[model samples]
Target: MAGTLQFDLVSPERRLASVVASEVQIPGADGDLTAMEGHAPTITTLRPGVLKVVSTEGAKSYVVTGGFAEISATSVSVLAERAVPVEELNATLMDQLIADASEATAVAVDKDAADKAMADLVAMRAAAGF
Candidate 1:
């Protein structure tokens, strides 16, 4: 059996998850990465995409608009700007998020990054069937 690491996902709204997970798939700003037990110590910025986790209970997913992830050999902690369980994502909510992203993009300092994030959100919405 694979080793498990303590994984926690939090947002300004609430703590969405705390579990012993075998793997965590992060939507990193630079790229996507999967963290497992005994992984390297590092931190990564998140982008708008689906975050996946596999644990003893089952596989779960979350939608994170942006955030920072702190990874260590024994743990992975995600502090999200906005986070929602994938199951809870609906068309109304997705539309709101897209509108928000569009506004953010207009005023963003880094236009390229904002554009990328907006693209990611669109892709996520499509994947969610919205």
Candidate 2:
């Protein structure tokens, strides 16, 4: 595992994934970034998008609503606000998510909240290939 890093994706409910991975794609608040073994240590806030994990076992993708990631030379830990495995995603679920986001956006009390909700909707749509 010299070229691999421990990656863990945790949500409020439970841990979603814990494995050794070659690379992980994260949706940083500023942008997307990829983490690999020997990467510089850093912390980043996450945006709503897909988190892709690549390892010897193959690739797996997860849809994250928002979160934070702590990256280190040998580990990447993701604390997600909400996450769902891509395998469980479907057009119907995507539509529901979009609709729920739209409602949240409409009810947002402030411009920042509204913007965030809108962005989440956009990201969810993109991830769902809508």
Choose the strongest candidate by lDDT: 1
Give the Cα-based TM-score of candidate 1 against the true structure: 0.93
Per-prediction TM-score: 0.93, 0.79
- Model 1: CA > 4 A from native: none
lDDT of each residue in 21-47, candidate 1, tens digit only: 999999998889999999999899997
lDDT score of residue 3 within candidate 2: 91
Model 2 residue 24 CA deviation (Å) reads 0.5
The root-mean-square deviation over C-alpha atoms between each candidate and the true structure, in angstroms, is 1.2, 3.1
* Lowest lDDT block of 10, candidate 1: 96-105
Q: Model 2, stretches more than 4 Å misplaced? A: 99-130
* lDDT (Cα, tens digit) per residue for candidate 2, span 1-130: 4599999999998899999999999988777899999999999987667899998889999987777999999999999988889888888877776666567567656667557656766766775686
